[model samples]
Target chain A: MDLTFAPEEEAFRAECRAWLEANVPRGLPSGDTRDGFGVHLEWERALYGARYAVVSWPEEYGGRGASAMEWLIFEEEYYRVGGPQRVTQNGIFLLAPTVFEFGTQEQKDRILPRMAAAEDLWCQGWSEPNAGSDLAGIQSKAVRDDAGGGWRLSGQKTWTTRGAFCTHLFGLFRSDPEAERHRGLTYFLVPLDAPGMTVRGFGRLDGDEGFAEVFLDDVFVPDTDVLGEVHQGWGVAMATTSSERGLTLRSPGRFTATAARLIELRRERADPHDTRLRDAVIRAWTDAEAYRWQTFLTVTRMSAGEQLGAESSMTKVFWSDLDVRMHELALELLGADAEHDDSGWMKGYQFALSGPIYAGTNEIQRNVIAERVLGLPRK
Target chain B: MQFAFTDDQLAFRDAVRDLLARECPPSVVRDAWTNKHGRTDTLWTRLGEMGVLGAALELTDLDLVLVFEESGYFAVPEPIVEHVAVAVPLLPEPTRAATGAITAVTSLEGQGAVAYGNSADVVVAGSDAGVELLEAFEVTTLPNSVDGSRRLGQVSSSGTGSGVQIGDRDVFRRAFDRGALGTAAQLIGLTRRMLDMTVAYVSDRNQFGVPVGSFQAVKHHLADARIALEFARPLVYRAAWSMSEEDPDASVHVSMAKAAAGDAANLTAAKALQCHGAIGYSYEYDLHLFMKRAWALAAAWGDASWHRSRVGRAIL
Candidate 1:
């Protein structure tokens, strides 16, 4: 087992660190807000210009076609220099992989470059009022409009992160009403400005307009917008969810950076006598290190042609739980000052709360692990 | 970075696993509890014949860790960690070739008891001064351990002509790290065994006319255990890699692995016992064999808290 990066990988890391150190904007607001979203879009454009936006994607698709190990190194370097969260993640990390895997030449040509450049911001339109955990219970309908050579979408999608700002959405709709849960659904890429569609921004727990409820009333999406086979959206969507829950969405770099920052905070504010809090900080740091190594193992397996299936569920449970615990420890270190502090720990804690709930809840992921990974009987 | 074992390493692991499965079953482990000296001579010789005892002489820490993990999987009642990981590597070339002679090592200062002390033909002790190979030692057997096969005892130099000075302080320090890394690998194996046993029990055992595994609570419990072990395993492997490479941060990495594996094993033991209900609590059940081994190992080299504190000093 070789844990040390090769000279080329280290060189790539050095380049990424230098670029991110110089280019990352100072004092940018949270990307969830309107002002912050615009600034974040500018950063994404800069990243794309440097060919660092989608390092793992093919070169033709505005990426360097970097290896998975290189991509992880890029992430580590990016976060080490305090790079902001990628506001374009829904399109770049989640939907882009699916599109590359299943999208036609036309879709790939029209979608990827713009998504990488943040010219066409996208949001996930999966969870609805009744379909948060049971994603297959989507009530959205896509009726064939033969005359218009398109589909007429009618549905309401809630908890659409940054939907108010995104120009388009990638979601699921029932194309075959007769087919029950998990079947009949077709993946659709709908423009937010499509006729009869409205996005209503709402306050999340953090009191930011980070979420929206998209109401679709007879919105027309042409056949070209369909992703994957019309009725096999479940399989396509699973691929995307796996990306969301696994490597791409949350890199170990993010947690390890947060862990480093937490250590700094402890050094600055922690009570020396509070051994419990000290221990908590240590556990948080080690957990981050553990996650970093785990990701390396996973990337190694993936590079060796192994497919990651239900095991991704274990990844989700671990990092999400670690994220929450790390933030909690940070806040405890801050003590009473945490309540009104603008140090981002409070905001990060609020965001971490959504990790376990989103990307399919931890409970659902555990069921997947037990039944699929462990071969436990499901009654 | 290739963070996986090579094909040769995996082959070695599988070979050891097969050997342990056949030679070191639960009955063999049970026998260690009542057997004189708590030693399985036949299994030891077989392992020696397999070149497992001479592993440190020919293999990297990365390769030897895989063997230690398999030994823990079978709950092999031997001083494999002490002999293979610590004592064997530090022993003189002549002494290292004597694979039949069982060796055990202990820290001279804080260690209260040495595992397999009675069975060991050579006892090595490490301290700030250096490492010493005791010529004649007296073993005072301690009380029966939670893991009956462990066989702990106090070792004192009997024919004290100040035992042979073998290695210096740096050698002892590195040996401690190797011992911890080996134990960490063992803990990961023990954790997997417990989780696997619990998953099987819950899948077959029923409650309210349905398999208890179907209950979300039971599924979540086992799932959490699996998650802990799954994540901790990479740390152990990476620690082995670091030690093999003689990385400057090897001690910190070893501490991380031991801390994580210790926590994962202890947590899995508790969840496995709870999920198995009354049957898991009984001594006759096979689950305790692994559960108790996990408990004893978790506290052996350094408990989770101690290792974490060590890690805390390094990072914080």
Candidate 2:
């Protein structure tokens, strides 16, 4: 198998490298401060302006319509140049894919471009306080209006990432009260600014308002806002969660960049006799390289039109575990200063802790692997 | 970038798999454990005739990788990995039959052990003057390996005129790296087989009036094994790719692959054995055959700790 990219792909990489080098912001603000979030939004706008925001999307969706290989190269270059994390990830990665897959042409024409441009930041509304791992257990409800014009939603969605500043929320709501779990649910696109809707910001473990509690009280949603077929939200939601846990949420390039940083940090250490730390550093790098190659294989399959099945759960379990381990090793290598929250390693370690819990727990992913991939009998 | 084998490579692998299925099945593996010299000469000759022995020199990198992986999957008693991946690349033309070498100085010293020291016509041994090929007939053999089918033992040249020097320091180092890569690929293949066997046994074997595979405990073990192999498989190929291209960081990638694959294979073996209950530990069963082979190969070229330190040295 050939590892090197074709000449045209190489040229695409060069183009990405040049654009990222010229346009990437310097000394970008970090954390959940208003100013920092605003700067990230502006950066997303700048990316959209250059058509580098969603390189793998269709041209009509305000993307370059690049190949999977080009997208991988873009991701590699984006991380290599220390590109900022996408503030619009929920919209651009999770909901946008679902919209493209399940939304009507009218929805696509109206929604994707705005989402791509970051004009309407989106937050997920999947997990409620009681429905963390068992997402189908969510109690959120939406009822059709008596006049048959719209639906009124009433629910509280916790762990809503970027809910504090996001303009919209996409979620699964119970449309039929009599129907059982995962059967009567309907996916909806709701405006956070709708009447009776409120977002209560809360501090994460790292003292950032990256996630919040979104409360919807009799919020009216038009019929046109329904994402997919009525009572088919479970299937639509799977598409979103799969994309969240799969390639888009944790790309190999991100881990590669982090592993490179860890290596740099290790090299900066004066003492080289710490074999424990040394081995950990190498393990981090090895796992990252493995993930990169594995993603290349997955990309090859995708290019050949092969759908990723339970393998996405395996990827989620692997990358999330690796992320936690890598960050833990980084903190250990940072010595006593690792205790400080201001240190980037400590912050990273805090964030990595949430990876396995979100999207889906590793325990659930393992169950998925056991049942679907290995053909094990379900309990 | 493509990460899959070409059509020719797949066909070659299928051929190897078919041949191994017929000639090197579980019964043959079990027989070799009890058989004298533990050498399957007929199978080795057939492989040689198929050009599997000279594949490293004759085939592309991907083809050789596929062959090595298949050899590991079948746990072929012959030293095809040693002959093709390590010894063949460095030796001159007109290579003798079924070369088995020990470039690791530890395996050579103290007891002066070398794998297949008896069956190999020419045994390459590492010494202070680099690597040299010694005529097996001239050296005395002391048999007994932990893996019964391996036929490993100590070999003493005894002033057989210091043997014939075939490669120097750099060549020896590259040989060791290739050895590690081959071992890594074998570990991956063996581990994959272990995983499949465990899945089949668990699905069919019942306990407490239900199939044990239905239990979350059993499923989790297999799931972890699958995940480990999935991640490690790519590293093996990447390392092989690096070595084939003679990349500057080839050594580092080789160390990473070996370390990752060794750890993955060892873990898979443990879980597979645990899942198989007491039957897995029996000699009559085929499970122990792979277990022994994995144990032998895990520490063959370089163990996990050794490779980890090498990678650490490069990166840190």
Candidate 3:
């Protein structure tokens, strides 16, 4: 029930704030969720080197192992500094945990350290052009070699995050056409430079080429490269995908930053005629704070080791959609000023518009809440 | 950090829920907007007696829980939050411990009868003036293109009512936050109910090919409604939770909760009505009953923009 940070945490917060004030970049992210790829990658390395990244991980793994609340303080300051998101998000957020869970001792030794240091750039190869939300629908097939050891893979996985630049790809490939939805898949770790695999780039709404259409053509993979049991790939991928409690890339406070930025954008143009716009700005203000508290509630649930359920789906869905609200208000507030992309606002607006389509579509999250969280039958 | 309500709050919530089902049923709400009198002396007296106006004020933990649940299930026809936020602080220890209103908010425009215009016994809303308790009468309805839940009406108040006027502006606005957070909680309930009602009705109702809900439009819209409700519910609770934490950043949560819940309730209520279609607009249908309450609460205390600005300033 207490909101104030303990004196120690507050002091730690001040220390971090002081550090950021000294070392962090001067300008903010221009409200564009997308950052320049080259700059973002370099920033990721610098952050990891400084140990300011991965606030929740064990210090041995290049993080501060901070308490959940302290981690939030870290994010609040990070956003205040307006630093770029960790460029190797797939490596840090998704794969590192998966490796820790299923990886062999050597695998952990080889990957975890690199992952912690951002030396391992990972791309997700789960979804295909046809498989959209249904991971089981992936037709990208992998077949066993004659020696019955390594496998040869051939298929197309699109919307592969950072596939163009990432060095490794962790993916779900159909190993047996006969196996049912949850049974026949295999999770594999394939180096991007492996023969037959090609990377093709695509543009995001942020105008960055972080996403790519990865074509897997007869790529070789040793048996040890498989993430989990054969024909049990779905289980591994599902566990990884559903690992909601681990790292929260979208901290609750991010909503606050987004809201605040909208207000700043409006304050520069503050005029009496802008009452409606001002009102929208106020709404964004409340929304950001409300959800952060809501997030605070969720964080406590997680800290108490509560199982991940439908309730947390609310945050992902709300934050993304509310983010759109802030932008829509921004667009409305800016009106004619909206077209002035030279100042980076229009780009920000477009980025917001694209948010719902990212992560999981808002529709998918609702289905999860309705069917699983609310215990309602699926339509 | 705990989600569990205190033992007293549990008992109080159960009682409030029980009382609401019997007293201000959706049917009554439906009736009032149509031909029936929305508020009666007895109804008002019962609410006062039940501690509806003062649940958060002076009641025990049990009383707070009761209002939380009440705020969820039944839509309050009056400014119960205003009563709780303004009156609870000023009530006698017995009443305050019981957690009911201690003092009333006074508004210059007075209680308009249509919830916001003159909904408070002591209007605690707005800056410049403090909680303005005025000589008030029952609400008289006016037709409008706006909300169905909030019947717009005009009222004149006697300025002689017992209440204090505020000299400082910040104090006036802070009073509104407590009420705003309370209403946002209610909006969560309303959105959930609307989603439930729409889901139940559509799942059964037949259409061109199959059950109308089987169609993608119905499913997606309901799903979207579900998403809105889910997203809003947490934010609403977050604000409430923050209030308990008494964090200065609570304003962050209050504004966020109000903004998110207001938007979600409006979206969900609209979709719920759309799903019910012809029946939704009819007087006999209960769909509009929820809609009206949602419409009224969405704009209460402050609208989306007001909340957004508070959040914006905090982070920026």
Candidate 4:
């Protein structure tokens, strides 16, 4: 199907382009830091204050109440200007949506405004060292703190991205040791200010300490902080992970930008009819461009409220695989220069390796396709 | 992102499956492959009558990927690609068959008689001149070593009219590209069939009181085969589609498809054979039927490395 924006949508895109031209300041801080988020927070708050908080959300909850297609245009522009990723990602992308569907009025009132303003930064607490894909195997414990009118939690959360800097975390803990693996868990919003909370940096494949190993000991939470119904954390957790899959991936246009850079790089070293070199260029272009196209399809599907089911898995698989293909081309085209470990091409190659592991590994995705889509006999 | 095949395609695929099952049945494959210098002229005529011979070729462009896919599906026991791809499509079809494989050549521009000792039945060769020299007449050639099941004959050149010759630049180029694409598609078909057969076999065959397919190692390897098949499907289809559309990118796509298809076929067929173990290599087993097809297809247009280098040269 053709993928041109509608006339009205195109007009909306132009308007957003102008607005982004006016906003999105130059020379901003990078990485996951307080200062980095400070400007990001101010920017979001300004947008939110102007009724641009949640493009697809209901106006009742600090949002523009826009259509999904319009929201897509907004996101497209955000990435176009090299705008900051949603700094309070936990609130905007994950928790708020869940809360909007399931939270009480008090929870909504107390949380929505602050989240919109970036006054609070939130990290996810899903994985323990033991429970990544087998998430129901959580080892974290949360005892009823009746005297404090809530709960006291104790646990270690690894791969807690941005945990060291974020002010809050949304987590699922084992609130009832006697309950079943999934049924016993309860979702909670925990503030880092709570006693015995510690965040320690950990190295990631990306060579950044953006992720942390967070320790929570005797951390107190008021009754109001509990999210959704107790022992039903699995459902909410799945929702969060699926949302993360949609929102956290590098934008398709990001690859477009990379492709532009590549075209420039190849220009200096290439000649027409250099078959090997030309072949490499075409392969690179196809892999990246196709994946980018496929991912854009996924985005459009999500906006249309279509459950891609295993197609979503297919998308995840495609981007990672394509990234690897692109990296291979980058290395080949670079010739002798590819040997440099610090080279951008090399870094891309290394980074592409994580693709299959995260957002569910390719093996896992294939399994999903086999079972859910292909209807292959599991045996 | 969307992998749904349309209803029309689904029906078309179903028809192909049925035809292959009945006409290109495993028994037929067994018979054809077991003998030396084998052929099924009757079946080819039947397929041609049904228009299935050109089912994959689009009228818009000389897209041959469709035909290639069918060849892969059935592991069809013929040099359909070479005939349809390299000769009929590239040169003139129904070029006069001579008593022997050899005939006289009017020009040296063609791949010299394609018939060594005996003359070639139909020799469509490329020339530097704008015109492709196609000669057809009653020609005969000496028999050569039967490398494949099909009988081998050699064709020769002399200033004679034993073989018919026609001059057409368009036909030669179209046929050449089609031949390459078709061979690639046939390999894709063969490998796909091998993988399917292996999957079905392993799922049924038991060891240690369990189906072999249930084993993790078996599943992973089968998965690998499936991956190979999938990775090349788009390549094959895109190339075919390009030819059908006569897209400027046809060569690029065709080269990739041919290269990918060759590798996938070779690797997947070998792996499938391994999964079937000793039985696969035995003469009586059905695995050889597919394997031979793969082997033949690989050598038909170009081998894997050749296509790969071509792809490299084009892209790099």
Which one wins on lDDT?
A: 1
What is candidate 4's lDDT per residue for B187-256, written digit by digit as tens? Answer: 7778878877887777678878877766656655556566566556666665665676676666666777
Model 1, span A208-292: residue lDDT tens: 8999999999999999999999989999999998999998899999999999999999999988777898889999998988889
lDDT of each: 0.89, 0.83, 0.67, 0.64
Off by over 4 Å in 2: A26-35, B89-113, B126-131, B136-143, B158-160
Which has the higher lDDT value, candidate number 2 or candidate number 3?
A: 2
Best by DockQ: 1
**Candidate 1 chain A, which ten residues in sequence have the lowest lDDT sum?**
A270-279
Docking class of 3: acceptable
lDDT of 2: 0.83
Error of 1 at B177 (Å): 1.2
What are the per-model DockQ values?
0.87, 0.72, 0.30, 0.10
Q: Which tens-of-lDDT digit does each residue in A88-161 have in candidate 3?
A: 77777777767777878778777777877767778888878988867678899889996958899999998887
**Model 3 chain B weakest 10-residue run by lDDT:** B103-112
Residue-wise lDDT of candidate 2 within A1-379, one digit each (tens)? 7888999999998999999999999767763655689989889999999999999999998998898778888998999888888888889889998998999999999999999989988989999988888888979999899686889999899988878989999999999899888899999999999998999988888778888899999999999999999889999999887888888878998999999988888887526887788888888888988889999998898888898778999899999999999998887777787887364778778889988888989898888898899998885
lDDT of 4 by residue, A179-278 (tens): 8778889899998778889988765676656678889998999889988887788776766656655433444555554555565567765665576666
Provide the lDDT at A228 for model 3.
Answer: 71
C-alpha-based local distance difference test score of model 3: 0.67
Q: What is candidate 2's CA lDDT for residue A282?
A: 82
